[model samples]
Target: MRRAFFYGWVIVATLFVVNFATHATGNMNLGLFVIPMSDEIGISRGLFGWLTTSRTLAAGLASIVIGRLVDRFGARILIPASALITGLGVIAIGSATNVVQLFVLFAVIGFGGLSPQGGGLLTSVPVAKWFVRKRGTAMAVTSMGLALGATTFVPVTQFLIGAVGWRRAWFYLGIISMTMIVPTALTFLRRQPEDMGLRPDGDADSRLGSGAAQRSEAADEAVWTLGTALSTRAFWMLTAALALGGFAAGGGVHRIPYWIDSGFDHDLVSLSISVHAASAATVMLAVGILLDRVPARFVAAGPFAGFSIAIVIMLSADSNTDMFASAVIWGMSAGTGIVSQPYLWASYFGRSFLGTIRGVTMPTILVATSLGAPAMGYVFDFRGSYDLAWQVVVAIYAAAFLIMVSVSPPRLGRPLAD
Candidate 1:
């Protein structure tokens, strides 16, 4: 029976790998194409930024709805369908002839590809529901997909763009996304371990020992409602902090090439992205270990501080060494920032309504990021430098830090009420 829990973890790890692959494939493909697409479509890079904004907006809006759907149905139904839609959208993007077509195709992709509420939500919520004792570690392992995807695919997509045109690269990627995700999702993504006649961690007798006994106690707790969570000051503070962090991170990340355009080489620019992903992965792993043991506010502050320092360095740096430093600092912060929000959500709200709560919170934050992306591009196009943009991002991060510091966890004894 103990082996059953390990099998569940094995499933979680497998899904994480798949999730990471798809995300990396999409992001790296888009980054590689952004400049070429602008040139080919005869649109300003600022205007082209709408492609991402459209995707993010659609995904954000879809999150809560998808979360409800997951609760009503199951991941087995949603994950494969989302993957197929994402693949189809990728194919459509490859076939697009004009800016209008590109926008429409990417919107479809955004709806399918960018719905974190669907894939990650489906994976993590179920896993969290099952494993009480090791929930933090499990979530961290699953979230690693985001970092792994970015690190592995950035270089590959860069190479693909160099070898074939971006269109052909997208075409090949579409085929790959469809072939891989469809089958694996169908086979492995069950609604719960109980569907297989096993508990979350596969303990046939989870109520046996004091250490293992906590599992039943956690499982018996009431799930939080969206309304009750919203009523808490902690929720508002977390949402504000997350939104500000998103704005800052999105603004800088979407404009990485603009910084490179100032005087850096393409390889160096790509390396910055890779470093950012790598650092984020490392930080997330560290935070995963700390999340259960430490206060949530400190975890939130660590990333914001890292981001602030990185931005300051980036704004000051004129050389490769400085850029490298900037990447490491910012990358680590970005990683921690990404993982910490979800950790906080679980910490503050509990696992029952995680999907719905996250669904609601994610869109608001992503929309901020969506707006930030194009706005930063416009800043570059208008101001001809990322100098002003970096300063703005630094301020945003500062605001997020302040918000986090002011917030505290909800009182432990109250039952979550709608």
Candidate 2:
């Protein structure tokens, strides 16, 4: 396979491992600890959810810093540092005994190691750099690492938490982070293809007799910088749609607790989340390939519709089967969105500026995602049902879907003709 395989694929596989480990310790996995940690620490559900808010706030800030680092220094440094910080944070989580501890520790985790599954913008920049023609497929497949992490970690954490305790689960994850992710980041990762004497997608050397020195993509391709992209109406529209989508996706944090509260079995709730992640992982390759071949907006829009339908199903679910059904649909849609966002950026604006551009847009997405958990918790705390939060999520998804369908790529000098 080496004879025909792209080195970019090697980079992808390494990032897959890095993402799997980082995401396994992320807030999504914290859903498993909602009841245990809150009960043990003697905090309200709404208060516990605020810890997620703190974590998101921390990551949102860190993303901006890391974004500059990514563009300047590259993933080789950031990925490992993020992993180590995340590991220490996870290990420290076991020691948390109060809301203060929870807030600080989770914030640390957010800063050190949260990707929302692409290690925030760190992973996306590299993918944008390495695979232009196949960026969609590469991102789709690579993004599966998060779902796969969830698929594996959710069930394992459930068991570990059930057996030894949540504390031990965090401890075990920290060990894995240090041992696995640290080495992988150091050895398997590279900054970009050019350093290795290759071109994006390994494009042919225009000079036949010469070695792999390649032509630049274009001198006038008009990469959208942060300021220029911000000037466009398309930027705001995509931001609005994605922020809402992010808010809706935040449903993952409270998924276990929501089901458990609705008289659903604890084991079943865990299984539903695991199955959801698995379902998303299952279609990631297909979505990746589809993004390469289709109009990304068209591909992106279906998931938002699925998100709406899934919320409707959640509203009336009566059994574990119903919850699982809803999760599958939601997971598939979530999977599609993860891959499409990066593809859309690369395709629409060009790859040269992806790191900075993504950095600019990330805070809203992360903040919106943060809002979901606390909103669900607050509504449930007040109303004693998840009904209100789900209702709001449904509306957001509807609005997001409409906005996404209406958006077009930003042009170089155009301001707001839309």
Candidate 3:
């Protein structure tokens, strides 16, 4: 019997919550902890910034193993386990007395929870596997969690730090992480639609059985394995483009600190994060539809171009008006970037081996990302300004934009259609 509603949408919703909860602990909110923790612990900004670097580096290395597990066992086991580990790790961070403790916990438990599958990678892959025609829309919806998490958590963390202490704030947020993520993930997530006897996009099975020709066509759909995909020019170019984008994206870790240094009120700095996230959330649905309709390369280029311009605006800004305007532009661009990378991976290579394909790229992307924030912090430490760091990020964005525009999907076998 045909089910009245698609189960894939349920999968999308589950991953949405996963994205939301996991990102609440992500580096975007690190600025909230940076000043307070560094002040209390007497660590320099450059040294404290290594927490993000450690987390990303560990997550990148773990992605090599986790990616294959996701492909083989699915996210059902991995995501919840990661969340559980993440929750305990985050709570442990509350009691940390030194840089070493923070580094070890964040790197191991935090990275274990969020990388390869949880943070954005695993959540996106399952959604991609569940839909083809609707892949872009599903991805757009899933990515809303990322925006929402930032929009809510930045201010909430800011408020919590003010009302209580940063340590207690960490405890509360960690509790929330486990409460929101672990139970739902265990209850709802499944490997793919096929495991439940459903086809991608909820297409009627009868369509494929209509004739011999259709059966042949279905059998001929392109399948790109990790080994073969790595051999293609598209793979390397896309990897370079995404890795550069990852590095640029990490600049968020210092955004709050930069604003505060620029003499903005603390509340105003937090508000800027909300504005950026809200703008990204608002544009994401439209970007998703555009991704489905537009050529993949053009859609991929939009974020890089937007980031370049946005950073330039931010560097020159001296007023509150200019700051918020920069945030809006970055938000719009970031929304597209969040959706485009995974969409490109699945659409370009096909979905069967998405976990493995995305996994292999993790180390390069995470390592590049790991470098960005500390680079900014150390620049500020040594130079007394963030001027040089933003300049470097702008160049990285330009490079990514050029590479992204040049990329075309690799032709493997018969084309896979939406």
Top candidate by TM-score: 3
- For model 1, residues 1-418, the per-residue Cα lDDT tens digits are 4762356776677667666757544663366577777788787767777777787777777787876766556677687888788887887787788988878876787677334422256566666655555666777787787777778777777887789988787877777777777788788777655545556557663334543334443464555778887878888778788778776766653545766577788877887788878887887777777876888688878888888898788778889898889888877876776566667777777766677887777778778767877888888789877778788888888888888977888865555342
Q: Can you write out model 2's per-residue Cα lDDT over 1-418, one digit (the tens) per residue?
A: 1226678998888878876776557545678888988888887778877888778777877877777777667788788888888888889989877789889987877776355722258777788778887888788767888789888888888888989998888898788767778888789888766666666786642232222222243332455677888888988888888888888877667777878888998888888888888888988889889888887877777788998898889889997779999999988987887788778877777766677787777788888878877888888889888887888888888888999998887778632221
Q: Which number leads on lDDT?
A: 3
Q: Can you write out model 3's per-residue Cα lDDT over 96-199, one digit (the tens) per residue?
A: 99889988987976467463222366688788878888889999999998888889888988888999999988888889888998889899998866666567
Candidate 3 stretches with Cα past 4 Å from truth are 1-3, 115-119, 205-220, 414-418
Clashing pairs in 1: 5-201
- lDDT: worst 10-residue window of model 2: 205-214
The C-alpha TM-scores of every prediction are 0.90, 0.93, 0.93
Comparing candidate 1 with candidate 2, which one achieves the higher TM-score? Answer: 2
TM-score of 3: 0.93
**Cα lDDT, all candidates:** 0.71, 0.77, 0.81
Ranking by lDDT: 3, 2, 1
